[model samples]
Target: MPQADFYILPSADEDSRYQFLGKLATRAISAGHWLYIHTDSEHLAERISERLWQSSPESFLANSLPTEKLHAPILIGWQPDHIPNTPDMLVNLSTIFPSQTVEFSRIAEIVIQSDEILALTRGRFKEYQGAGIQPRMHDMRKRSS
Candidate 1:
């Protein structure tokens, strides 16, 4: 069974969310895990791709879009039809829950502190549970304290 991990951010700022995603992607890649970042739109995917490239001054996180012929360890995709099946982990940044959740060995759901986001994530949490996966919550605010 696949495992789901929900990362709850302290702020609703988009920059903070992307920063956390960069760190998470770096850690995942360092651990030899291939990651696929799923977004809701092409615009968001492009934004994330840009952020990952400019994430660190010392080193940038290498990522590629799904349309690219040569894919890096981390892939960013917005279209629902192009979900890559090869990645070991899935980083969901979309509003809708991914139907192919079980395809990946691990899943990461990033939720920022906001009423709308909180409600969406709550539904996603239940969906994961319904699929027989016990999702773990990581309160990033607590960690920052």
Candidate 2:
């Protein structure tokens, strides 16, 4: 299962976006999924955790976390979105920061262009072809069946 995290653009209504995230958190809780909220602010993480803890002590998260995803810098990871978090969810949550989407996109583009090495090194995957890699998706399906 893949989990997703979306950081709100700072200038956009921070309060509303957080409220939406809280709702997602509540859903996560009910599903028993792990929520990893990566944020730059330690205090904000604690405050969010505290609020969630109040609603479902049984599923309350122990902490907020930091993320190292290259795309999202100030990421927070939390789990179990059973109770949608509201602005009042935290007493000491930090203010949102403006997103550097354009900057990050440019950097990613540059890196990907420079790393054409993946195409050059595809031969390395050829050895693993026997294990799983296939030349085409249809061929892989035939083998699995």
Candidate 3:
């Protein structure tokens, strides 16, 4: 079974979620992992790609949209049918559970502190458990304190 990690953020803002995602992507890349960041729409995918470029003041994380032919370290996509088979990790930013979860060795689900988000993440947690994958939780709220 693939390893699943849920990162619960302190804030409900979208910026906070994407900031943490940039950090996660940096760590994963350093550990030699290719990542596929799944979003709910093409606009979001583009938004994330832009944020990654300014993720850090010292350096920017190299990422590419699925439309780009370049084999970037991180590939961001929104469509379910366009999920890349090569990435070792999947960073799910979408509200819906990814149907093709078994394809990746690791999965990262970023959740914010909101009623709707918490409820959605809870369902995803159960789905992961149902798939025989014991997901780990990281309360980022404590980490930031």
Best-performing candidate as measured by lDDT: 3
For candidate 2, write residues 44-143 as lDDT tens digits. Answer: 6656555654535465433334432233112253322311232112111222211221112111000011133234224323422433323221121233
Clashes of each: 0, 27, 0
By summed lDDT, which 10 consecutive residues of candidate 1 come out lowest?
Answer: 78-87
Select the stronger candidate by TM-score from 2 and 3.
3
Point out the higher-scoring one by lDDT: 2 or 3: 3
- How close is every model to the real structure, measured as TM-score? 0.95, 0.32, 0.95
lDDT (tens digit, per residue) of candidate 3 on 1-145: 7999999899989789988998999999999999999888999999999999898889999999978887789999898777886648999988887889777899999999889989989999999998889999998889886
Predicted structure 3, TM vs. truth:
0.95
For model 1, state the Cα shift of residue 69 in Å. 2.2
Q: Candidate 2, 7: how far from true, in Å?
A: 8.4
* TM-score of candidate 1 on Cα atoms, chains taken together: 0.95
Model 2 residue 50 lDDT?
Answer: 54
Tens digit of per-residue lDDT, candidate 1, span 2-44: 9899999999887888999999999999999999899999889
Which residue runs does candidate 1 get wrong by more than 4 Å? Answer: none
